[model samples]
Target: MNTTTAATEANVTVATIRDWARRGIIAATKAAGRWVIDTASLAHRIAIGAMKRPAKPARKATFSVETMLAIGGSRWQKNGMDRVYINNWANFLPLEIDQYKTGNISWAAWEGQEIANRQALLLLGSIDKVWFDSADGELHGRFGSGESRIATRQEVWETVVAGIRTAIAAL
Candidate 1:
């Protein structure tokens, strides 16, 4: 199969097929100066991907303000994230929020007024998309660098709570 067909069949980009060909990850040969991937090999690759998916729903998820702040670290207390993750839970959210109405001051303004130099980790940069797996109680994502990375759940939770503390103090 040609690179275009192989990519579609494998549910990946054409560029990925080309890279696999160049790296000998799949069996391929030049035809009309283009890659002709082996269908059987592509099928094997697809099987491997299926085995790696998370058991949970795998829906798109964003970090909460506390989670993002925790990822930013000590600096978050002074300078909120340079750009809020998920457009930031705090950006337009009211300062004094309740079930009935939102306060006049926004959290984004609050952070800017309180701190500076706010750019840092809200999630692993290597991973382009992130999701939470409630069943396993873990975060799952594929790194852009073409490999899997692992971090302890404990560390994630600690930072999550720390961020909440920062927000409470800002209040």
Candidate 2:
């Protein structure tokens, strides 16, 4: 039968029938320059319930500000940083973190700001002068010229809190 007639009989769109034909899900042949679908094959396949569209994949989850804050806040407390300092940092950091979480800012931009925050805390004597060297991918401390080690974001938060603890202890 003609593509349109076959599609109407199958209760599907002509486009869907054409796609099935192209994908070899259903068989078709050209007769006198017109596409002809065999009714026998189509009916047999329909009876057996073989025709179906492929399922789409689910979306992956992105990072959230709440999760980041929880992890960072826990680390801050564990590192013995002063409550006042931790509270102040927590209050200001959320705006930027939210921007990152919502994808308004890139990962590189967020990392840059984080690095700047680390530097500022060091200058204010709230934390030791620890810096991340992007060139060599190493973290350096103020006490020594050489790199101490590489650190993850959580580890960086720990270091920042430790610095705050030291500054408070000195007071």
Structure candidate 2, residue pairs in collision: none
For model 1, residues 1-171, the per-residue Cα lDDT tens digits are 766577657755454676798899898986533466888898998888789974444334343444444433221222432322322322111111112144322111111122111111222222343333333434343343322122233343343333334343423
List candidate 2 stretches off by more than 4 Å: 50-171
lDDT of 2: 0.41
Clash counts per candidate, in order, are: 2, 0
TM-score of 2: 0.28
Instruction: Give candidate 2's error at residue 139 in angstroms.
Output: 58
C-alpha RMSD values across all candidates: 20.1, 24.1
Candidate 2 displacement at residue 53 in angstroms: 12
Q: What tens digits encode model 2's per-residue C-alpha lDDT throughout 19-103? A: 6666777788754434568888778766665446443344332223232233232212335322211333322211122123554
Global CA lDDT of candidate 1, please? 0.42
* Model 1 alpha-carbon drift over 4 Å, by segment: 55-171
Compute each candidate's TM-score over C-alphas. Answer: 0.34, 0.28
Error of 2 at 29 (Å): 0.7
